[model samples]
Target chain A: MTAITVDRLHKTYLVPEREGGLRAAVGALVRRRRREVHAVTDVGFTIEPGEVVGFLGPNGAGKTTTLKMLSGLLHPTSGTATVLGHVPWERDRRYLGQMALIMGQRNQLQWDIPVLDSYKLNQAVFRIPDADFKARVEELSELLALEELLRKPVRNLSLGERMKCEIAGSLLHAPQVLFLDEPTIGLDVAMQRRIRSFVAEYNRRTGACVMLTSHYMADVEALCRRVIVIHHGRLLFDGALEELVHRFAGDKTINVELADEHPLDPAALGPLVDGHAVERSATGFSVRVPKAETPRVAARLLAGLPVSDLVIEEPPIESVIEQVFEATSAEVDGG
Target chain B: MTGERLDADWTSGPRQAPGEGGLAGLVRHDLRILRTYLSLGVLNLVQYRSDFVLSVVNAVITLATQVLGLSVVFGQTTDLAGWGPYDLLVLIGVHFLIGGVLGLVVRPSMEAMMEGIRLGTFDFTLVKPADSQLLASVQVVRPQALVDVLVGLGVVVFGMTRVQASLSVVDVVLSLLTLLCGLVVVYSFILALSTMAFWFVRLDNVLAIFQSLFGEAGRWPVTIFPGWLRIVLTFAVPVAFAVTVPSEALTGRLTYTSALSAAGLALLFFAASRWFWFFALRRYTGASA
Candidate 1:
């Protein structure tokens, strides 16, 4: 069964509007104005149980709005979504009990208490049986290496430590579906990798479906095989991670090394890949050409120039995602 | 990756997940969760033993100030507006009791929830499977306020000794029930105001006005106030219900209609505030960025 299925889900917000100054404020008191903000416009996607999918977008691209809706925290203006055979926005107790949403920026754990004490509060609220609570605590503590941190007050723990405890505390219920919104937003690279692996490990151990949003490319590269990319509240691409690169990262960089120990003239290299960006170097230049022009441009460069070595490479995933957003945002701006 | 499956049991009780049956079951589940939050607050307080001493000192000083305020008023006449000094002591006791109750869970939790909404952490509350109102109202508990609770009881019993009237079992029971209703009325008022933080976002000063009004106005006997104003307090704001109606029940002066009125207004206050909380919460979910 599908863990999550969202069809033509849409959200629009109406926010109060007013100009600055005393006169406008007085005017607003007489007649308030509102402007409609279309947060998510007819977005749709689905994920099967046990799959980890990356949710990608620029700021205000409705990534969070979609996640909020799927987790039952939001009611969309239109359309429908079900997570594990229950309509999410209905907020059935059984549904909430079976799913978890962990936003890295927010702390659900009680601040002044020991981490384990905070976990006990969750135990009481979620009403986990005693034996299960103990066993799951033991299992998660071991898996997360939280034994040392569990006894310390949450305020005393380091940021990374707090996040570890936070994740472990949230998973005490062992939910079937996990929505992680920017779960590794501000961690250092090593801690980010640690959390990424921990999430992957937890997902593997429980076979839970994980939908994650992260600004860090490494996080998506490590954990997400399939990705959904949205820009300006519209679905831009949804495919394999590599396919996203291949589809939107349309440029290929060809780095050339000169056979002769002499500087090459820029004017002489004008015939090949004329519209592309040909950045110069001491040995030889590197030119970024559209993927379609790579082979012909390479052949032309090989025949026309004094080249010792040439390497053709697709751009990094970070640049690829950036290109996807920039190109899509431009389209949005135009229309 | 470790492929070992977690022996997770979702169908099993955390304590027995809420929907077993009926209203009583739901209340029991919610009360247990409240106990968890309260005990956690106590455990957190243990980390700062000095705070307990400070609260004690503060409570005693506050009690002295109230006694002095009462003395100055009583010094002017043998009995002011037909209330013996000791009868008004019961009123004083109810004031501190309601104050203590408000400080303990109602005010702190409201402030915490307000800050949570402003900071976006209230999202954590909405995500919980429990009732949002229950979670928000008890999210932060101050153990220090229990000192006032104890002191308030001490004053009530002490005042009972000096009074010239006998309290029957029904009087005692009615007094306790009215007192509970009083607390509910005050809690509902504070919560309704706190919920306004959803729309206003910066309502830290909102409770100050209510606190001062409740503090200053609750100490006086409701009968001492003018007729129209007393009716308004008894039904509308319910500050009279907090400090007057209960003491009136305790001192053998409570009429059944007043007791019934207190009960009715308590229910009204609770229903109104509960409705207001969800109304604000809906806005919060829809409008939070």
Candidate 2:
């Protein structure tokens, strides 16, 4: 079943245009001007039950705006969206009870209260049965390793620990759909991996559809199979991560380690490959070439230079996604 | 689903949640908060024992000045505007009691709500499946104000005894009902004022206006004011309901028509306040695109 269906959603905000200085500020009080900011324009997507999808976008690309609309925290100016067959913006209690939105920068937990107390409050808010609430809390505690931290006040926990508790508290109701906006932001790699694994495991166990937005590609790489790329409030691409890479970035990076520190100019070897240039280093050089030309370039370089070690890798997903946005912008300019 | 089975699963009660729990649940939740606030209030008094002592002394001095003012007014005659010294003392007591309750939740919560809106924490209140007004009103309880409530009650009892008016069951019930009605009126008035925050996001001054008006008008009887000013205080701002009408009931000066009018106004204001809250919420979510 389609747990979430959004069709041509649009959200526009009337942002006041202000000038600098005290004089302008005083003038604005009398006669203010507002410019329309189309935060999300013609955005649309759907998520099936139990599917974990990653929403990728740049800053100010309306990712959070879209998530807010889906979670019922925001009302779109036009178009329609239904989560679990209920219009989100209507904010029906039954519909709210079946979904949750967790933002990394925003905390729902009471700062001075213990994590357990916050969970208990969630129990009341979500109307979770005591047995079910207890079971879910225990399971989340085990998964997030929150045994010792449950007694501590939320203010005392580290960022990662607080995030773990935040995620756990949000899940106390066992929501059928989860909206996560940069859930693993500002965490160390190890902490990010832990949270990513926990989210994956949670989805696996509960069969809840998860829609996550993050600038961190590693998070999407680890947890999401289907990726939706949005830029400037427009959907750029929606497909598997691998397909995104192949469709946007058809190049491979070759890093060659010479036998010795060769005093050879990188530009000297530029024409040897198909316009491939050595990126920078003393003992090693990195070259970027199209996927089909990688082998030819490597063969020519190996036969010509005193090569010792070489490694070929696909470009990082971040770069691929960046190229996708850049290509979209170019297309708009061309049109 | 059966009520018994639902009740068994929800350890708290058959109520959906703290806020969602119908009227009974709301009352229970509010009472629990009151208990916690009472404890915190005691703790705060102990922490600032010196301040409390000083404030109590200051209050006594203030009360002496009020009595002196009353005596000065009565020096010319036995009564001013048909209310004697003892009757006026009861008015002061009722004023303090009502002021104490408003201080406990209304004022602090208004300020807190403004701050919450500014900081985006109000979203937490909105997302919960509870009455947003109830959640916003009772989210924070100030315990220190209980001192005023106790002091007011003591003064009322002493003043009533001194007046030598026999307290009947009907009089007592009427006083309680009027007091409750006064509280509801004040709550509705404050809710309407705070709902303005949804539009005038930067107008923290609106609450300051309420505080200043309440502090000034709440101390004196509406009857003492001039005709136009009396109408403004009675009907426009409704400060009369907050103290005067209730105290009038206690002093046997309340009319059945006026009491019924106060009750009717209380109901009207409560419904308007609820409607305004939902309206503001709709605007908030809609405009926050």
Candidate 3:
């Protein structure tokens, strides 16, 4: 069954226009000008039940806007979306009770209260029974390793700890759908990994659908197999993660470590296939080669040099997504 | 990599959410949420004792200045605009009472609502199943204002005792009804003004303007102002409804027409403010465009 289906969703914002200087400001006071900004234009996608999907975009690409629309926090300028068989913008209590939205940049906890108290407030808001609330809190605390952290005030916890508590608080009701917008932003790598694993496990346990948006590719790599890429408020790509890499990033990286500390000569590697550049480091050199030529280049490097450690990897997801953004923008510019 | 799957199943509750119930049930749920908010506010106050002390000191200084102003005005004249010393005392007490309620709940909540709209955190409020206005109104609880309210009650009692006339039950009940009407009017006015933040984005001075005007005009009867200013105080901003009308009810000087008008205006303001709030919310959510 489909968990979410957003059809031709569009959200356009009319931002007031103003220029600097007192004269212009006074003029604006008399009669303000406005310009329309198409924050999300014709964006559409379907997310199946229990499927974890990553939303990838740079800032202002409308990822958050789309998430807000899906979570019923926003009303789209046009089109419609349904989550778990209910129109989201109607904000049906049953729908809201079955879903949760966690924004990493913003916190839902009271800053001065203990994290557990905040969880209790969510319990009341979501109307979880006392026993169920306690059981769920215990379950989430165990999963997120949040035993001692719940008693401390939210302000007293570190960013990572606070985020973990936030995740726990949002899930106290055991929502069936989760819209996590940059849920791992500003967290350290370990904390990010911990959250990703928790989300994956939560999905496994409950069979809930998850749609996550993040700047951290590691989050996507660890948690999601499918990704939707958006740029300039338009959908650019929607497919499997491997397909994204294969389509936009055609090259694979080869890292070679010499058998001994010796001077490396670029000329010796000479005219690497397809004129790909070799980047030399203190201990090793990495060269990018087309996916088809990866085996040939590996064979040549082993046959020619004293190669001790060799590793071949797809270009990092960060660089690959960046290339996709640039490629899409270049296409827009060309058209 | 997919994490190891856990076989734990969701222990689902076969029940609808609290807000999905009937009207009476929804009211009960909202009241429960309000109790939680108030208790959380008390917890927050425990952490900021200095703020509590400051608020106490502020309330003291405010009452002292108002009392001293009464003394000064009484020294100059036995009565101003047909209002005697004791009558004006009741007015000042009513002013503080209304101010205390606003400070305790309405003002802080409105400020938080403005900040939330500015910072985009208000979305959390919208996504909740409960009524958005109910959530926003009780979102922040300022316990410090309890001092002002208690002091205002003390002032009202002291003023009424100092006067020669004993208050009949009808008088007290009438005063309370007017007070409720006044509070509804004031709250609706503040709400309508704050809702403008969704469009203006810079209303920092808006509430300050209300406070200043109310402070200046609410101490006296709107009748004292010549013509235009009295109309503005009574109709435009409703400062007269908040303070003077309740005082009139207590002083037994309220006309039946004025009392009826207060009730009618309270209803009008409440309905209008609620309508404007939803309109602004629709605009903010881009529902119109």
Candidate 4:
């Protein structure tokens, strides 16, 4: 069975609004004004049991609202969603037992107690048997290198260390469906890689479904094969990560390394490098050309310049994703 | 980092689905959860050992002020209203005892919950696979408040000796039961007040106003208040039910109908507060959201 199925999910919030200053505030007292915030629109997707999917969106783009709904922490304004054969918003005890939602800034562990002690509380709440609890703790600590941090209170741990401990504590229950919202936020690059690898390993071993959202594209690149992107509370695209890059990235960058120095004017390179900005160094310059014109551009550069090593590459994924957002907003403004 | 297949570990006994566990089993489950929370609460208190010692000093000052005030009132007259000085002492002891119980767990947990709501840390609480009300009502405990409990007990014992009141086993049992009933109502009332944080996110002063009301009016018996004020104490905030009814039971002044009403109100308030809690939860626009 599919681990998650969401159809036409929507969430709207009515927030009070008033103009700044005393006159408007006094007027609002008599006639309150409220604006409807459509946090999540008619979004629909289904994830397989063992799939690792990336949820991509800019800030306030409804990524968090959708995750909160699927994790059963929210009631949708209108829609249907079932995770592991149960309606999420019903919040059945058994449903909650099989799933976990870990938000990076929000910690479930008790701050004043040691990390292991907080896990013990989870052991009680989740009704984990002794043997399994012990084994899971041992495995998780070894995986997270948390043996040293387990005995110290959470407040004493650094941001990265506390995040490690927090993730370990959330996993002690061995939830089948894991929702990680920006789990690698505010960590150094090395720590981010460690968390990303751990999450991949955990998902592989248990055959659990993992849905993750992050502002760091490295996290999405390292862990997720498929990505679903949303903007303005609406779905923009859902496909393989490579397909996303191929669909939005119409231009390929061609880099050339010259064996000998060549004094060449960028204007003399002709129309192939005309519109694009060519980044120039002492040896060679790199220019972006349309995917169809890469071969023509590469041949012309080779015949025209001193003999050099040439390479053609796709644009970086960050620029590709940024282009996707920019194109959508341009459509919105023009429409 | 290990490539070892964890397939065997996934289907193990750690994830026990909700089964046909009987009511007794459910009670045991809840009791275990409560014990875990209590232990964690104690561990937290242990970290702040100086706070515990300071609570003792605060307790001593509070008791001294109460005694000095009682002395001034008793010095001028043998009784206020229809109650003697010793009877009033019993009422004062009951007030301290009830307040101590609330300060121990109820007040601390409510404050923590409110702060969590304000900061959006309450999302963790909503995601737990347990009764949200029970979890929210007891997440933080302060054993430092036990000083008030001990002082209250000491005053009750001393007052009984001075009055030389003859008490039977049934009288003691009945008073204890009434005291339990009174506490239930008080807990529910405070919970309802705290639940307002869902709609009014910045209600830090609400509790302060409530404390002042209970502190000033609860010192004298509800009977001494004006008619409107007495009704308010008995029903609105219910400080009278929490302190006066238990004191009445101990002093042989309780009527059977009054005793019955206390039990009824306790159940009604508990149900209403529970309903209100879930209703407010649905309205909770999370700070993060």
Candidate 5:
């Protein structure tokens, strides 16, 4: 079952451009200038039921804009999107009740009130039954470990604690589709892992489709099996995380720990491999060579010098993603 | 059987626990928010005890001034537009009463709506299932305005008794209905004004203009104004319906035709404002997209 279907969705914003100085500001009062920004253009995707898909993109790359469209906070400039068979922008109460959108920077909880009070307000808005509402709140509180925090005013809670409450509040109605835009942003690694695990547990138990966009890769890696990468308002890659690494990573790193510090010329080792990249430390050095050339490079190094220890490692995910984006931009520029 | 069982399990899936506990629960809900607003309004009035005292003093001074002005005018002439001092006092009292209600909820909410739009907090309102217009209008309650309401009601009672007018139960009912209609008219007028925030982002002066005009024109009967100005206040801005017509109903000067007209106008404006709210919401979401 497909929980979300977005087809050729387009969203453009007309942002006013104002020059500095009093003269330009005064002139703007009479006649303003605007430039059209196509925040999302011809983007299309579908999420299967219960699938936790990570939305990956650079800043200003239309990730938030697309999520806003999906969540019914925004209307697309063209095309259409249906979540759970309901058009999002229409804001049908049934559709809104069945879905939740949590933004990291934007808060829905009332600042002066206790977190529990804010949740109660959501209960009324979502029309949750009393029994169901109570059970749901208890479950969220226990899972998020929000036993003590619920009594305190939202303004008093820490960022991580507030985010937990915010997520819990949004899920009170047991929404079938959750759109999370940077839900774990600005959180410490521990808090991020806590939220990631909570989300994973929620998804596993409920089978609700979750589409999360975050700058933190740990959030994506921990929770999402399938990731959708978008760059410059276009889908760059949509597949498994491992596949993304394989497609973008060209070489593997071989680090060797020597018995003692040794001075070695990088140029001398270069001729033995198709491509040679080397970084040296006091007791060890890491070298990157083409995957196929790893055996030949390792054999040549071992024969040439006494090797104490060696380990092979795949490139970091961040670097692989950056390389993918760089190659994509290069292709676009080439055209 | 297996497919049916799977469907049933999927439909009746595990429910997540509620977010807040009991007291926090009440505050979080919408109805509870309204209750808290009212209680907080009372609490706020207690906190500003001096302001409340000053307001009552101000109301007494204002009522004294209105009576003195009426007496001075009637001294020179037996009657101004066929209304004696007491009749006009009733009108003045009704004006304050209606204005008090507006100040209590309508005006503050409109101002809050404008501020919410400016601060981008209106998005918090849009996501809720409640009608955005209703939520924005009743989000805050002003306890200070209750003094005006009480003073206005007191003036109405004293004026009626002093005039030696026979106040029947039917007359009281009619007056109440007219007052209710007047309140609706004022609410719809403010709502329509606040809805303009979607298009005219810089409309701070717009709501202020209504208050200033009402301060001046609401003091007098609509008949005292020139024909065009009276029409503008009556139909265009509907301030006449808010105060003048309702006061006339209490004073036994209201005609059936005018009462019907006020009622019709209130209904029309209420529907129009509701339509405008949805339209503004559409434009807001569309433009932001």
Candidate 6:
């Protein structure tokens, strides 16, 4: 069953324009200049129940804007979206009871109180039965390792700990649809991994659909199987992680090691593998070649040099996504 | 066309939680949620023990200033606008009482709401299952302002004892009723003012204008002010109804007409404020367009 379906969801904001100097400030009071920003344009996607989809985009690429539309915090300027069979922005109590949105940078917990008190407030807000609420809290605590952190005031906890509590509080109702906007942002590598694993475990346990946005490739690689990529208010690519790499990234990288310990001179491979970026490292050198040429290039390299070992791998997902956006901007600039 | 699209997909239909969709059910659910907010507020107050002490001191200082000011005025005349010294004391006491309620829950809640909107945390409130207006109104708890409430009650009792008016059960009942009406009016006014934060986003100064005007002009009876100013305090901001009308009930000056008008105005403003709040919410969420 589809848990979320968005059709041509778009958002446009009228942002006021301003210029520097006292004269402009004075003029703004008299007649303000405003411009329209197409935050999200003709974006559409669908997520099945229990599917964890990564929403990938650069800063200000409308990833947050699209999430806001899905979570009911915003209304689309055009198109329509339904989460769990309810129009999100209508804000039906049943719809709200079944969905939760957690922003990593913005805290919804009471600042000066212990995390447990804020959790109780959520329990009240969602009207979860006492036994159910307690059971869910216990389950989430074990999943997120939140036992000790729940007793401390939010202000006292470190950023990573606070985010864990925030996530736990938002899920007190055991929402069926989870919208997480950079849930692991601004955290150390270890903490990010912890959050990512917890999210995956939670989704598995509850069969809840998860839509997450993050800058860290490790987060997407670890938690999401499918990703929806948006750039400049438009959908750029949407597919499985491997397919995103396959479609947009046309090159594969090969690392070739020589029998001797000395580093291989990158210039020696000239014309043999022309039009590929080759870099030399301590042990060996790696060459990026078009996906179709990878086999031929490796066969030629083995014949041309004293290659002891060779391995071919897809470029890192981060660089693939970067290439996608760069290509998009080039197209945008050309048009 | 969108309706057809929604219908095609909703094979299971939208789940209707039993006994939980109507108005009464919503109110009952929101009241329970309010209890949690209040408890959380008290927990916040417990964390900052010094704020309690400071609030008490602040209440004491405010009471002293009002008393000193009243005494200085009494030294000039035995009566102003047919209200004796004790009568005016009762009036000032009501002012503090109303102000105490506003300070405790009304004003702080509005300020919290404004801050939430500016910081984008208001989205949290909007997404909650409860009604957004009820959540915004009861989100902040101010136990420290209980000191001001108690002090105001004390002054009212003392002023009543000093004044030689033969009070009846109806007078006492009327006073309480008028006070309740005044509270509703002031809360509605502030709620309407706070809703402007959805548009202005920097309405602290605009809110302060209401605070300063009510504090300064609410001490005296509205009748003493010039004709145009009296109209404003009475109808513009409803300060006269918040302070003077309740004091009049205690001083044997309240008429049936005044009490009825206060109640009617309270109802009117409450409805207007509620309408404005949802309207603002629609605009904030970009739902109207």
TM-score of each model, paired residue for residue? 0.94, 0.87, 0.91, 0.96, 0.85, 0.94
Instruction: List residue ranges in candidate 5 displaced over 4 A.
Output: A18-33, A263-267, A270-277, A290-295, A333-335, B1-80, B85-89, B142-147, B286-289
The sequence of per-residue lDDT tens digits that candidate 4 reaches over residues A1-335 is: 89999999999989999999999999998998999999999999999998999999888999999998888888999989999998987777778877888888777777777888889888888888888888888888777789999989888999999999889888877888999999988899999988999899889878889999998999999999999999988999999999999999989999988776576766776564656778876788788888888898888878877747899998988999999998998997899
Tens digit per residue, CA lDDT, model 6, A209-311 = 9999999999999989999999998998888999999898889999988888755556767766875778877667888999999899999989988888999
**Predicted complex 2: CAPRI docking category:** acceptable
Predicted structure 3, TM vs. truth: 0.91
The local distance difference test score of each candidate is 0.85, 0.78, 0.84, 0.85, 0.79, 0.84
Off by over 4 Å in 4: A272-275, B1-8, B13-25
Query: Highest DockQ among the candidates is held by which one?
Result: 4
Model 1, A245: alpha-carbon shift in Å?
Answer: 1.5
Tell me the lDDT of candidate 2. 0.78
- Runs in model 2 with CA error above 4 Å? A112-116, A135-161, A188-190, A259-268, A280-282, A330-335, B1-78, B285-289
Give the interface RMSD values of the models in order: 2.8, 8.3, 3.3, 2.6, 8.9, 10.4
Candidate 4 residue A97 C-alpha distance from true site, Å:
1.2
Question: Which docking category, incorrect, acceptable, medium or high, applies to candidate 6?
Answer: acceptable
**DockQ for all models, in order?**
0.50, 0.23, 0.41, 0.53, 0.20, 0.31
User: Which segments of candidate 1 are over 4 A away from where they belong?
Assistant: A257-267, A272-275, A280-284, A302-309, B1-15, B18-24, B286-289
Model 5 chain B weakest 10-residue run by lDDT: B1-10
- For model 4, what share of native contacts is present? 0.47
How good is model 4 by TM-score? 0.96
For model 1, how does the per-residue alpha-carbon lDDT over B166-249 read when each residue is reduced to its tens digit? 988888899999999999998998899899998888999988988888987888888889999888777767786578889988
Worst 10 residues of 3 chain A by lDDT: A266-275
A104-148 per-residue lDDT for model 3 (tens digits) = 988778777788888767776778888787777777777788999
Question: B178, model 6: CA deviation in Å?
Answer: 1.7
For candidate 3, give the docking quality class from DockQ: acceptable
